[model samples]
Target chain A: MSLLAKASAAHLAQLMGPLDSPAFDWLRTPETGGVMVRGRMGGAGAPFNLGEITVTRCALTLRAGGAVGHAYVQGRDKTHAQQAALVDALMQTDAAATIRTTVLEPLQKAAKDRNDSRARKAAATKVDFFTMVRGED
Target chain B: MYVAVKGGERAIDNAHAWLAEERRGDLGVAEMSLEQIREQLSLAVNRVMAEGSLYDADLAALAIKQSRGDLIEAIFLIRAYRTTLPRFGASLPVETEEMACDRRISATFKDLPGGQILGPTFDYTHRLLDFKLAAEGQGGAAAEAPASGAPLPHVTEFLNKEGLIQQEVASDETPPDLTREPLEFPANRPLRLQSLTRGDEGFVLSMAYSTQRGYARNHAFVGELRIGRCAVEMEVPELGFAVEIGEIELTECETVNQFQGSKTEPAQFTRGYGLVFGQAERKAISMALVDRALRWEELGEDNVGSPAQDEEFVLSHADNIQATGFLEHIKLPHYVDFQSELELVRKLRAEATEAMSEAAE
Candidate 1:
């Protein structure tokens, strides 16, 4: 296999395409719990529980061959994974048309579908609370 | 309308579930037994054991299986496991002269005391592929010699008596383990030699060959190369004396190199050495040559600008696991950094375009 196929998490982080938010902006936001992803070396098999490694993984595709790229870190950061995957997919192909049709479109659709579903579910449970007062003139 | 997306925990759980399902695909097929890996994939096990600095065949096999044939991962597993293992004490150096030989040969002498037993080597065999193995047919049974079980004498002992070879003076000084200690610059001979012994076979081979092809051309003759089983002994604090822990097969290579005496010393033969796990003759021989070449500084010889002469380069880059790990880790993510670079590039281009347009007007 080519060297790219054997790339690791640290390398993946460096190759990640673009940041969604500026560093200052992310820093300004309130600190919250992070995501964790865990994986071990080996083909996905009856994997012996090789200790739980906390990882944050994000996935994004770019306008390239139907390349779905994934970035996984040891902690939670959906944005990081997404950007990493986007970069990976972008690195795979130079043809913008293929990238758009294959990677970017699917990722965009998936993101939209996810957002719409969440909005629909949240809308169902929306509660409006207000006090009505008659003005005494 | 927009909603904050959160399913990371659920997604991870689902992905793991899918991965597990994928790993054990079509469960109807016979699962691979650990013994099958140990026996069939013996070479893989050997590599893991050698690199991991662990000798357990079963554990090595399991690591190999767990790694899905990734040797470095298996080595990593073995190393991690080995670190956790309680250290009782260090083992005494095995008396290789007393080694029960399966194979012993000397290039310096036509006939040695122990005699040149060809033993089991692929040297004489034709390079043609065996059709029977391909067809999964059993090979011929191993011809067992009637157990003579005689103690073998070393080829070097004879030279030692005649004062032709330099005798190693016994010292109580403890040699440091390269794995335990971080490698420092201007490493001592012991430390440099330790790393070379456990170094990658192919890498060491090339370095040694480079010496032969006039890179560091130190005329090396394989004084002796012996492969055999030796008993390992560990000292028990309570018990007072050392006791036999176990036995391991080893390949020991000692090479006599041509050395023209430098300014301070008289002309005398010097030695290149290799001691490694298992019966790896090629690795042992290569190690010996490299070891000799590396000793140029201490032996008061001219520093012939050679790769072997560069101690830091040889010692640091010799490990396959470290080299592979650093090389392969580039696939992770760095979109955050990339975006910054992208912004910089775009900004630069915009500034350049505006400057050119103003000049034209």
Candidate 2:
């Protein structure tokens, strides 16, 4: 999975604690925008625009290692976008291993756990139907 | 002569204030929260999401609250909000074959590969109201079942292999975005399907019902109906490969309809397809029937002149927002037009009376 895909807005918000005040320049300050959502007839059919949704995006370059990181998240949360970008930048440096384990792994686990619990609730409602064979069949 | 009515700004302001008060209802009763609507009234949210063509449950809930549970009004709110967003690049066509299905059923087959998984449907429920739900602290949790493994193959594939069903040809041409552009006449299949998916559910349902009632009748069997979450991927030009963007819940229905062979063709079953955002099986199924009915010209079927078979009629009237706007506009001042009619009647009556007096003299 891509780092961006792994880092959902909620996960990033929870994972990213206070940054160490590392020198970084704003490559692109957080800005609110919209994105057109599209869908196809079937999974692999002709595409059409569903509608547009609000999004926030930001980009930054770490002064020390010159690693650039960008983030785009749903809704108008600028601070969430900035924090996500910061995490992205740190993931490229020597702190990559630490961040992956402490931040990314935990977030992934939490997401998986939530999905599993939901599935379990749904499964409880699943009905397995059986047909009784008539004598003549 | 009629003059335009002057401002009723104060009356309008007072009306709005009264409406706001009415929207809150009895203060003794608990106020409805966005979360409660999102969780408890999820089906309404699903309908709004499907019709609004936007899939955010939270936003749908908010719209419902703001509209005071008037679903059509809620849909309008969502549609207005959706028009302001920007255009990111289109994601690759979603892979429904890999959908983690919650509900899967086939009307044609008794037992098939992946088995029929009826996930969270109200199909077999008794229609009687549950009085238990009204009592406080009477809610009970549903039993949990483990998630099934492997993606279920589509039921139509079996018919496809036998050369019985019409083949769907893959195309790379960019389909038109209905939301971004004005609708054009004689819309192609993609455009028609797009309109039908976001079209008013009740309108589409009635159109589909018309077909079953012998108006442009096409014998249709639900080949497959599946509801699940499908992965949405987008090709990142910089990354040079498509990456998983997100997953969205979808309802897909494929209908197999009987078709007679034309002079140049052989008899084979044709398909009508419907896919929409969220678990909206009724909308999806209705869309498929209406879609097939609208394809009369392409299929070489005679124009029966039925409302369902008329492309212009179905497409034009399907949108609730458009229909409601014109329907509700009757409440607006029409004094100018009414006054003209009133003058014509007066003159005609006077002429008749004058002619009668002359005859008497």
Candidate 3:
């Protein structure tokens, strides 16, 4: 998993919607092995290392320039990272209520279903506990 | 068809059941009680509390019993439990001068205001095994003399009057919590001292011994070593005042070390302090010696380049729980990492053989 690349201050301001811009900007570049997302925590002017973390981030600018949605995933799933980043960027806007109902909840439900299916498949292999007894009689 | 080994969870459950059965031993034998372990194995409980950095005697005792008397495992249990508990508030610093001492002694002074009380010490006891102790219920409680009229003031205070020892100035500054925060290089005294107090006894002892064997040796004399109970207090924001939460037994060590004058500063005997949970005098003393050895840089002495002087190494490796966990975890399944390594080695060997043949041609 690649770390998110950093973004310049001017680009960050232009990218995110007005009202409550994130203190930091992460890069959402897709690499060969996996998607790399880097976190830029805290506000500008005195940004120090939060950490070089493996993440995937995506940003979507809405129509009417009212909202910018962003999402960040810890590992290298590009689509997941993009969706998460989009959610983050959108949550800052006035359209958060609609997006939450239409997107975030559904995505979470889908992930849970997929996880349950995988868990069932794994559990199928579990053998019942048994003990064998031997006698010389 | 070989279905890959996929019963890790089931195997783990079975292993746990087997372990429980093994721990219980024969059904005819009675199970060990928590009270029995607490009272009989108090030293193990003390070690757990010392390493765990928690003061609850009952919890420490329980942890010792659950961990089968493994001090390090008990410490790990306490530490894990401590993380889950919410910290309501920090308490005011306990005044060591006012400590109700059980054992107090000053190596620097022969006679001071308070006469030395060598209470419950193995210092003068012969190393030969006491047969009486092996035979249970052989000893009777000794009658207590009324507690000495306040500890005869610390010996270091007298040296402070002579201007020979540096007078320590107290500050209202708050120190960072090491457990909550990631450690950085060049830590302050509070953080360093905190790490030393909960550090592994064997590791601290080795580091302290190294300093004496000419590794960053800053000749130190034990100014005083005292073991006693001190009350813990907390300031209640709603109540608008401090409240006494509880009391804990502690061993405190203060070392007076030779501090040759630096270019700008005058020569005076500097201090190295150690404070730990319970009556662990040896650990406290070792910690004090190591603390002094690590202070060479701050005191403007030459960098002797000793392992004890290496702050990053000492602080990082001092904790046995972290060290042992990481060390023992290698026994767990690492097939993926090993497979990758195997592939890389094969590739390298093949490349090397090809190069050797070409070179011969």
Candidate 4:
């Protein structure tokens, strides 16, 4: 669910390509609002409101007797929220394994790749003291 | 003292129309898309997000475009828009320890667990203008190496373990929101930190600079500075536990300030913190310094009587939108006030003229 929220809407939509969405009822229609972001003092102390970040959330019930799906995603993309909610509802049904293999697994891999690439880029800038060695070398 | 002086409707409309056309500017040169502004003018967007107290880059970019690149105006737009939206809830205190750091460095230490990653910095670059950027697609992929996934702990933590730095006990007490309540005197650390993080960049920078020049001097060392994305988690009514709703880029700065001690307690390295939206290291560092300066009383230091030390002064004036509103208000019609001043000066001048004639006689 966290990974789903973190995934870019475009990328998620791309990953969900050709998966036919079942008919569902909007339990709670997609709505955009602000969430006050809080941070701890010294990164480990008491909390303080930093600022607000925009979030779009939605809840839907699958008409085919599956569980209710709820999604809270970043930004104001209603379609993204709707898609996420559909995926959540679908995960509760017998289709859980299929959705996991089709959507979640690929997203997890993509996320891992992104994290690896970022870490790799940072590793490049590490100072190898041996490179700057003088007389001893 | 206040009266509506209306009757410039036509002229005002014309001015606005002209301003709109000016914002568009020479249509043939191709209009700047929001995407281009978001990517190219990112610093401007970051500044707006920081000061405006909002974290939507697309909206910030749009505000920049709408304001014709007037950052303060863009901030004002965001703030105004912010008030109209419903606040869903407050997020759990983000654990920056888990940040996927883009750049992390410790100036106090030569090297640490996380080696100094100078990710996309301009620190060593010459100030010469590169004409190539004036054209398109000058940027290329950055160099990369095999991942060395080492834990990057906060530099201050090591000092804490050795009792070399002051240990801050974590608290769960909810801090006051200035946006909801009016700022009161003798503000606490949480409130002060909140105000500083969102304070105007230029104003906070100047305050920080003053401290360096010996006004409420608090010798600050960059204990650790990290910029990266972190997940924002919130517990939903539907979901039993908190789940990540979003990831936001933040610049966190922890500064080791001048050691402080009371008669009862021993002197140890005090700390100041800054966590701001996006990769705004300059703003974050400035915020940290001012934050330390404001902590004089709490840290058992004497009253320095500096502008930065005055919580009321700094927090009240740190918001550029509020400051600019009051500052720019004078440009509007002051007709009645001016008329009274005009009459008083005229009468005084006439009286002086008569006295001069009498003296001459």
Best by lDDT: 4
- RMSD in order of candidates: 30.1, 2.7, 22.6, 2.0
Question: B28, model 1: CA deviation in Å?
Answer: 6.5
Q: State candidate 1's DockQ.
A: 0.01
TM-scores of all predicted structures: 0.66, 0.91, 0.70, 0.95
Q: Model 1, range B1-361, lDDT digits (tens) per residue? A: 2334455788789998886576556789877888898888776776676666666677778898777777887877877776664333455555676666667778887656545655566776899998999898967744443333445576656666776654555544465555556889888766766677667888999999999999888999988887766655445353366544345667778888887889755677777777666667898899889988998887888888999888988999998878877888766445566778899999999999999999999
The count of backbone overlaps in candidate 2 is 6
lDDT per residue as tens, model 2, B1-361: 5586799999999999988888889999999999899999988998998888776788999999988999999999988887765555666677678877777788888677877777788898998887877865565666677776645788878888999977776666677878768899989888898789899999999999999999999999998998887765666454467665456788899998998966645799887888878888998899989998898887788898999999889999999999998999999998898889999999999999999999999
What DockQ do you compute for every candidate structure? 0.01, 0.48, 0.01, 0.82
lDDT of 3 by residue, A1-137 (tens): 01112221132333333434333344434321211111010000111111011233354555545454444333235555444455555667775786566655554465445434433332332223446767757
Best model per TM-score: 4
Report the C-alpha lDDT of model 4 over A5-89, residue by residue, as the tens digit. 8888998898787788789998999999999999998888889999999999999999898589999999989999998998999
Off by over 4 Å in 1: A1-137, B1-29, B146-150, B351-361
Query: Alpha-carbon error at A78 in model 3, in Å?
Result: 50
Pick out the ten consecutive residues of candidate 2 chain A with the lowest summed lDDT. Answer: A1-10
Lowest summed lDDT across 10 adjacent residues in model 3 chain B is found at: B142-151
Q: What's the ranking of the predictions by DockQ, best on top? A: 4, 2, 3, 1
- The Cα error of candidate 1 at residue B246, in Å, is 0.9
* lDDT score at residue B213, model 4, on the 0-100 scale: 94
User: Which residues of candidate 4, in runs, are more than 4 Å off?
Assistant: A131-137, B135-137, B350-361
Error of 4 at A70 (Å): 0.7
Candidate 3 per-residue lDDT, tens place, B1-361, comes to 2236576898789999887788677899888887777677777777887788776566788887677667888889988876754444455666667666667788887666665666567797779987878886466654444333444477778888899976666654555567668878897666777788788999999999999899988788988887765544445453367544344567878888888877655799987777777878989899889888777777787877899998888999999989999999999777777888999999999999999999999
Q: Judged by DockQ, which candidate is best?
A: 4
